[model samples]
Target: MVNQAEQIDVPCADAIMRLLERYGFDTIFSIPGVHTVDFYRTFPERGFRHVTPRHEQGAAFMAYGYAFATGRPACCMLITGPGLLNAGTGIAEAYSDSLPMLVLTASNQRAELGVGRGCLHETKSQHAVEQQIAGFSHLVLDTANVAEVLHRSISLFLTARPRPAIIEIPRDLLAAPTRVTLETASMFHPPAPAPEAAKMAADLVAGATRAIAILGGGCRRSADAVLELIERLGIIAVTTNAGKGVVPEDHPLSLGSSLPFEPVRTLLEEADVVLAIGTELGETDLLYTCKPYQIPGKLIRIDIDPHQLTMNFHPSLAILSDAGLAAKEICKHLSASVSGADRADREKIVRDSRAKLVGEWSAEAPKHKAILDVLAGSLDRDALICADSTQLAYTGNHYYPSKTAGAWLFPNGYGTLGSAMPAAIGAKIGCPSRQVVAIVGDGSFLYTLEELATAVENRVGIPIVLWNNRSYGEIKDAMNAGGIPTIGVDLYTPDFVAVARGFGCQAILVESLSQFGAELGKALSRDVPTLLQIDADGPSFAELAN
Candidate 1:
């Protein structure tokens, strides 16, 4: 069948912009360069908010965070070659978590595309690089296919698997007169499990002496459905970092996040049956070395990707299905059988495990609870927490409980540092009505410090919480644990509050825990960007190694 096409007498850039806006994307994160200037020029005419991050990589990460935060697909654009390569890391993170987004990158001139004559911004293959990092990648060489290609890219972004999609539109095409036929982007959902499979799984759960659900990133899309099923059945639940907040760590049935914590680890070890959903059960999330139970119990794995069924642990039941649909079906099959004194007894175990765990974690946390206490107390119920990858991030991951799913923008899959600031900026833009905050270590904060300017320019009012310890504390802890002397890990301290103020952000330094709550209150109340820097060691990195 021939793909859709139509002729429109306008620059390719103009057509692309209108098409994206029509497809429900009102905001974009981008960085412009010579090859991509044509598209950037159309931004004013398109009337969409274009957020320009300080770095191309940060732009891509911002886009990822936007989509992850709002449960909506987002878009990003960058210059060709070096710009595309810079976005590779962010694209990989989106791919790992199956975030829905579109990455539109400029390519060398269509005429000079493949010729090795050293054309400006040329690459070995821009499309090829993008293809490896996203769910789908297509090169639009013909101006006629501009709208069609972009629409299709959005469709791919929202559908099956729901990872990022890329469209590489060559620079020449942006100015070329083109045939443009706008098509509404379609959504293709992943297939649900067969009725028999759903029934079998439900029956197994109904009969289990002890059963628990292990949730992951993929389940975020179907959080409500999963939550309903678990709550209705009174089944205890636990989550990986990417899946944290699905059942609300505050919820009594939730064992909270699995890795880098003790309760979920001990509980998983003692379970007679495990029902894993929408996650690869990755090594880091597994906290494999932290525990001794490799295959804790009989497994029941459900995932959209068939390739992941047997990845880490083979399951007694592997159901190929959409997490939400399968969960709904299983709830139907086990409607009346999930309740009883026996189930209540098992649930008490989950509650007991959580209490024991929280009591322990909270004990140590109160010692350094200034940041934690202030954040927990001051956070808006609907706020989004975009956390960087560092010692403090891990502490927040374990200590800060999310009441809503998809509201926690964590750098889990790729574990990249410097993601918190830009991601928080994107989260704020994606859901302007909801508050967004960034929590980062000083080392990671500097990696994307330029974005403080991005936040200032865009008027994004995210409160950034900086843990200034003057060292890569996690790395230093690793050295100490490994019996090596810590060196080259210390960072030269800076006047962070002064720096933030210079960037037009409201800024303050918390010299002691006594000053913590009020400073955070000030930052959160500001309508413009703000920063709170605390000189501290968060949760003791060594505890996480356990």
Candidate 2:
């Protein structure tokens, strides 16, 4: 409870805390340093939970995970130069995946910013360096504009395309005792669809004999609208990795998030009208395929960003609106024209595509499928699975079927290594009631392995499925496929189970595929995180799968 006496006049840093509370920011992830220690001046008064990670990168990734899982932005407080620099990679990954985050850092004093008097944590121009990663970076010069600037950042996250926003605060203003006005956070609505464009798209979709809809990350909030539109139009649907569970994979009209596969590409080639919503048809969405996407159809694109409307693929009808609003507008115009006759044919196409894709994946990577199947069956409907940029996650991006939106989180665009463990910890922190797990590769797990102590200290009961291939398996495969000599792919590996045990986590080495389910169940009920190590070249997974 905030003291009534102290509310009259407090430190400038404490004033910022009150504003953050008004904006509904209740949690912060940080590793406090001398420069920014004052930022935590009123944590006890404001009732904000502070999670401290070993490194600044872990802090940023944790913020990303919290935001991705709950669809709300989290705050990160860091020191000056090196602290901000350490967090760049995670911020960039958040930008690539369109996650909402607010990063606050201490900068050198305004007088010492570019003067280079060799202050403790001085840099040439910290805000300039950070501008490249965050959606926008601002150097706060005065205490008066703090409320307005923070309001802008929160508004962008709620109403526009979500991305990380950075605020660089000078050290002098942090501790100054001053009075600042706190404004109420307003409700900002997203843009609505244009009627003419919606009508034109409805006509094109209604006239097409064969059509398909591709859902992307932008459709996450509008899953209900997306489901309604697809069911009304009676067309087959697919998703990009980011849009994994927008349309449940178990649905008959759903083709899963298999955009990179040949079967989906073939379907896209034959489509007469393509409705691409909330996703950029970027190369990352169609991984492993050198063949360019050929869309001879009339493409209708709906997105909030105007610049993205003409990117990569040209759209016949481009509507600038929120994905959910645009979908509802299109469906309003489409109800009379579409019939129920084509749904059965579309379902058959999805089934055939699934069969062909299963045959291909089973032949190429049976172990990954076998592992994913077990995980899918073991978890609850609301379980959050955080994946890293590893071979197993690459396969699961398409092969795994998620039943709910926001359930599957992956670092697809930036493709960063060692993200799964920290991200899963953040997810668990954000939604304590739901089950959370991390699926990471041996090569990527080492990137942030020190975070195991953070999980153990916080008692985040997360299950980490470590795929121990003992090398950079995906890079080696790519080099072999290209007939290039393998060079830096192989490396020495350590005993991960022992390492995890040393960090006070439950650890186990699975000898066979059959033991996975029982161990995972045990891990979920424990007080600390668990590390389950599985060898990629171990006992045959095909035998159990068959």
TM-score of each: 0.91, 0.96
lDDT value for candidate 1?
0.78
Each model's lDDT: 0.78, 0.86
Q: Model 1, 49: alpha-carbon shift in Å?
A: 1.2
Q: How do the residues 166-213 of candidate 2 rate in per-residue lDDT, one tens digit apiece? A: 988899989877665544557778899888889888888988988999
lDDT of 1 by residue, 400-506 (tens): 77878887777777778888888888888878888788988889988889888888888788888887778988778779889998999988978888988998999
Scored by lDDT, the top model is 2
State residue 42's C-alpha deviation in candidate 1, in Å: 4.2
User: Cα lDDT for residue 454, model 1?
Assistant: 87
TM-score of 1: 0.91
Cα RMSDs, all models = 3.6, 2.7
